[model samples]
Target: MGESIVITSGKGGVGKTTSTANISVALANFGKKVVAVDGDIGLRNLDIILGLENRIVYNLVDVVKKRCRTKQALIRDKKNENLFLLPASQVDDKSAVTPEDMKELCSELKEEFDFVIIDCPAGIEQGFKNALAGADSAIVITTPEVSPVRDADRVIGLLQHHEIPASLILNRLSVQMVERGDMMSREDVEDILAIKILGLVVEDQEIVNAGNLGTPAVLNQNSPAGQAYLRIAQRILGENVEIPSFEEKKGFLARLLGR
Candidate 1:
């Protein structure tokens, strides 16, 4: 069976959705069938990030309501055929689908795909619970800021309470700021969260540009953030790829210039 993973953050604006879109594309590039589900009802945008916004006819709510079959709601990726998107309902609120419904939907998707990635909504409300319902594993995303880190710590505790395995993905990290003692380092965040590090995505403008253009950063070979996400996908597949040090000034510069 396929693994159902949730990409979540305790707070908004932490790049959780971006990570979900990029990781889904990365796994698809590795020859894995992947489906990304947007768990944020009433404010769905996973389709836009995947560049499949114009193709969404049936959404998650439609499937749950039996208005259409699961296959009818899936939007296949234009770049990678192995990737698909199950968009959330733009009209319905978070209460439209229960946690049990999410579990059943994820289980059904796992039967046909190699990976099911749920882009969870921010906060620990009903939407968060629904997103966590079917996830076998979770990737908690956070930035170096104090508020995000504190929120991530709370999320990790909640995951532990639910007996769900989780790892940390530190996003929007700035190496120069860390070196200058202006930001927290990877080790510092890990120490506070007490979770295994899945990956570290450095601050890169190319990621923003890629998202704006409806292309995932992971598909951009020249992007350092893309390389970091690819390595994370390899790790998810049980590969022992060495994660390069992003703390060094020269190493950061080299990666930024695509060297």
Candidate 2:
């Protein structure tokens, strides 16, 4: 059997969707069969981030409502044959699918793929509940900022209440700012959140360029964020890769992030 991981945030613009895309690709890089499920029903952008927007004819809602087969909604990645995407409906509201529906779909998906990565909508509403319902474990995405960290804490509480295991992926962390005392250190954020650090991703121009080009930063061998993602992926698959610190000679990737 496979595991389902929900990538969620309490607020927007914290790179939740981007993390989902890259993480899915990173897992696929290991030759695992992976599916990226867009759980944000209405304001879906995972498709756009994954650059599979033009190929989506059916989506999650379609499969739930029996408008199409679950197989019909899956859009296979052009580059990674093992990576697929189940897009979300742009018009349907959260009311269109319930937590029960998510659990059922996720159970079926678990049978088909090695990993099911859900991209949750921002906030603690029905969308968040639906996303959390199907997850075996969670990756709470947040930046090293006050507001996002606070919001991520709220999400973490909810996850705990549901008895789900969760870790933090501190995104867009600036080591320069942390070193200069201009931004919160990784330890500070972890102390506030009180969760295991899954991995850290530094703010990088390469990540932005990869998203713009409809590719995952993990595919790039030299990207600071890409290298960090590869390490993160290794950790997810039960590998014991060390999280590098600023003083390490491994360079920027070491100082970037981890859990």
Highest-scoring model, TM-score: 1
The backbone clash count of each candidate, in order, is 0, 6
Task: Give a tens-digit lDDT track for model 2, residues 1-259.
Answer: 8999999989899999999999999999899999999999999988888889899999999999999999999999989999999999999899999999999999999999999999999989999999999999999999989899999999999999999999999999888788667788788888898899989899999988898889888999889888888899899999999877753233455547631
Q: Please list the residue runs of candidate 1 whose C-alpha ends up more than 4 Å from where it truly belongs after superposition.
A: 248-259
CA shift of 186, model 1, Å: 0.4
lDDT (Cα) of model 2 = 0.92
- List the global CA lDDT of all models: 0.93, 0.92
What's the TM for model 2? 0.94
**lDDT score for candidate 1 against the true structure:** 0.93
Cα error, candidate 1, residue 141 (Å): 0.3
The 10-residue segment of model 1 with minimum total lDDT is 246-255
Clashing residue pairs, backbone N/CA/C < 3 A, model 2: 197-259, 198-259, 199-258, 199-259, 200-257, 200-258
Taking all chains together, each candidate's TM-score versus the true structure is 0.95, 0.94
In model 2, which runs have C-alpha deviations exceeding 4 angstroms? Answer: 247-259
Residue 76 deviation, candidate 1, in Å?
0.5
Residue 82 local lDDT, model 1: 97
